[model samples]
Target: MRLIISGGGTGGHIYPAVTIAREVARLSGNCEILFVGTKHGLESDIVPKEGFAFATIEVRGLERRLSWQNIRTLCNTAGSVWNSIKIIKRFKPDVVIGTGGYVCGPVLLAASLLKVPTMIQEQNVIPGITNKILARFVDKIAVGYKEAEQYFTRYKPDQLIFTGNPIRPEVMSAGRDEGQRALGLDPNKLTLLVVGGSRGARSINNAMFEVYKHFSGSPHIQILHVTGQNEYNSIVSNIKQAGIDISSGGNIIIEPYLYNMPLALAAADLGIFRAGAVGLAELTARGIPSILIPYPYAAENHQEFNARALERHGAATVIADKELTGSKLIATIESLVENPAILSTMAEKSRESGRPQAAEVIARLALCLIKLQSNNKR
Candidate 1:
């Protein structure tokens, strides 16, 4: 089968698109895939590296309120739709799938206009504006959270499915011992993994000072903090000024990012993370109990919605961005690590809630869509 997948902008959208594409390819054994995304989005850089044929459309997001910029963007979107039409015609895909991003808007619209089978995957409890609008046109809507169904008001009930979020195969396959050895972590100590996102979280970075200060040189646990690339320098300088020892062989490992995050997640006993849907999916896939600090300014405050859902599942605890502080963080960490029972219970719940096979399920659903379309054509 020939498939076209579009999703871009941030890692949250891009990663899911990539994972879904990989899953689909794995299942079909003989499939050709094309990825459509904006040149400016991270997909341009990441898609090629992932060994997928990548294409781009020039489109920008609209402002919340009416403005000259929004008008310009809308005009550009029309041209993008035409551009997408050309790409879709040349690719002649059996199915088109969108994972959710502004870049998916034109590609999915063009596919729908062409009457090709189309589906979208919504990854948050609060549906993104792009996905919400595309729901009316797409053939199916695969949601990460069941709570998101109520928000997509325009879609037919039969069109929606809850398949959970797709996680990379590596995330499920990585081993704890291999991860520890690869990252130079000690197997005997409890490993705490802290990450904000690809771009990093300033609040989490700032709040971690106390965590480092408190846990420095502790024999029981080791901290691996991924300070977003932009914030790494300042955070490291601050650590030096604070006289905290993060030396070559110290118990703490501070870095800008981890390309091998599946390994990191495998080695992690606990996690502190921003409440991006993809990040939360990985944490749960690994069954690592976590404290989620939702990004305050996310569209529709969806990060908080995502975090609260996990909290309800007893898989994670929510610490609002505004309420997060070094002292507060230290206390939460202490509370969990000190009480083995609570952490273990959270881990079990987290493991229970994980849909490790979500990618495969969604891939099969897409294949079914393709088959149905072929039947209707016959």
Candidate 2:
């Protein structure tokens, strides 16, 4: 089998594409897979590291408003379509899959035009502009949240599939004890994990400083904060200036990044982070309740929609980014932690909402499509 998968820009898109690629390889060792993404996207770094064949196309997202940049983007998009056609013709993939990003626009569209089977995965309740446009052309559409269905009304019901967002396999296999030992965190204490995506959010880090200060000397609860590389030095300096010795604060662990995120997620009793679709998927899969602060700048305010989906399921609590503060965050954290019953119920609800086998399901669908196409050819 041969497959072409494309998604990029943010980790949310990149990780899902990688997960699906991994599943495809696992299910069919003989399969040949290629990933197409923009040269500047995170995929350029992540895909090759994961050992997938990688290709690049020159593409740029359309600016939201009229500008000289928009003019250049238009020209680049046309060139991207031609480039995508060339890639598809040479690779002759049986199926092309797009996990959602600006890079998906040209690649998937070119596949559709070439009469090859194409699939797209939408990772948010509110569909991204790229996926929304491609929905009309693709053969199948997979969505992380059920609410995403209404946005793609142009497609037939059968064309839309609710295969929850794909999660890394390691995240499901890692155990709490294993995670605790990996992070050097206390096994007996309640663990709180704070993350603001991979790049880090300034507002979240700032609010977290207050939460850290309040929990500084607590022996019953431990905090693992991933400050993101960009904010780590400044956050550490501020902690020192405030007279708090983070290094000696036995209950707190601060790091610029958590390279072992599977361990961190496994160890966490509670999560405080942005409501990116991918992050939400992991939290639900782990049955860890979270306080979601949606990135207010996300296109179409989709993060809020993703957060509300979990909140509605009783798996998470939503705090608008604008409303987040140290006191408010700390209060919410205390409320959930202090109440074992509420925490347990939230955890159960999260598990109920999780789809750990989403990658497997999507992989099967892609394989099915490839099989059908090959059979038709024969």
Candidate 3:
């Protein structure tokens, strides 16, 4: 079996496509999978390292503001469609699947034009430009949230499926006891896990630093903050200047990033982070209660929508980006940490939103598309 999986710009899009590819290969032996991503995207570095063969086309997202760069980007994007057509012609796969990013726009357009069976997986509550355009021609659409369905009402209902977002297997395999041991965290003290998205959120880092002084002397609760690699140095330098010792703090452990986040999430009593689709999915799957601060600048303010999906379910609390201050954040954290009953209740509600089998469902749909396409040829 052969398939082309396209979609990638950030880790949010790249990781899910990689997870789906791995699952597809595991279930169907001898499957040939190829990834299509942009030359400027992280996929160039990420895909090859995973040992998957992939091709890169030059593509750029549209500029929100009026500028000459917008014109250049528009021309480049048009060129990308032609480039994608060449890739489609050479690979000639049985099916094409896109995970929803700007890169998907050109490739899925090429797939649709060629009359190949195509599928798209949307990870956010609000549809992105790529998914919105490809919805017309794709044979199937898998979504993480049921709320996303209305966005594609123009399409036939049969085209959309809510399969949830596929998470890394390592995330599912982690256990609470193992999590605590790996991080040398105490089993008794209330532990809060703070992570920005993969690249890190500067707003979240700033808020944490502002309130960290209050926790300096507290022995009742501990903090594990992942500053994200890009912002790590500045965050660390600022903390050191504030006279807050990080190395042996009795109640705090701050680092740039956690390579084993699944373990950290498993061990956490509370989580504070941005509400990207994967971050929310992992939190829900592990039943980790969180204070979600959606990225203020996301296209269509979709992060807020993603957070509300959990907040309405009683799984999380939402703090608007503009309203997140040290005092407000600390107040929210103390309220949850001081009350184990409330935390437990929230954890249960978080689990209620988790869809652990989302990857399996998407894989099944991919195979179904392949089979349907093959039988049509017969």
List model 1 lDDT by residue over 1-378, tens digit each: 999999998888998999999989989999999999988988999999999999899999878898999999988999999999999999999999999889999999999999999999999999988998999899999999888988876768789999999999899899999999999999989999999987789999999998888888889999899998999999999888988776743789999989999999999999999888888888998899999999999999999999999999999998999999999999999999999999999999999778888899899999999999989989
The Cα local distance difference test for each model comes to 0.92, 0.92, 0.88
Candidates 1 and 2 compared: the better one by lDDT is 1
CA error at residue 44 for candidate 2, angstroms: 1.8
**Reference-based TM-score of each model:** 0.96, 0.97, 0.95
Would you list the clashing residue pairs of candidate 3?
A: none
Taking the candidates one at a time, how many backbone clashes does each contain? 0, 0, 0
Score residue 88 of candidate 3 by CA lDDT. 91
Better of 1 and 3 by TM-score: 1
Per-residue lDDT over 204-252 for candidate 3, one digit per residue giving the tens place of the 0 to 100 score: 8998876678886577778898888899899888888888775665778
Residue-level lDDT of model 2, residues 1-378, one tens digit each, is 788999999888999999998898799887899999988988999999988899999998987789999899988899999999999999999889999999999999999999999999999999999999999999899999988898988779889999999999999999989999989999889999999977788999999878877888788889998989999999989988888776666999989998899999999999998999999999999999989999999999999999998999999999998998899998999899999999999999999889899999999888888788779889
TM-score of 1: 0.96
**Deviation in Å, model 1, residue 377 alpha carbon:** 1.7
How far residue 207's Cα lies from its native spot in candidate 3, in Å, is 2.1
Error of 1 at 223 (Å): 0.9
The order of the candidates by lDDT, greatest first, is 1, 2, 3
Off by over 4 Å in 1: none
Q: Candidate 2 overall Cα lDDT vs. reference?
A: 0.92
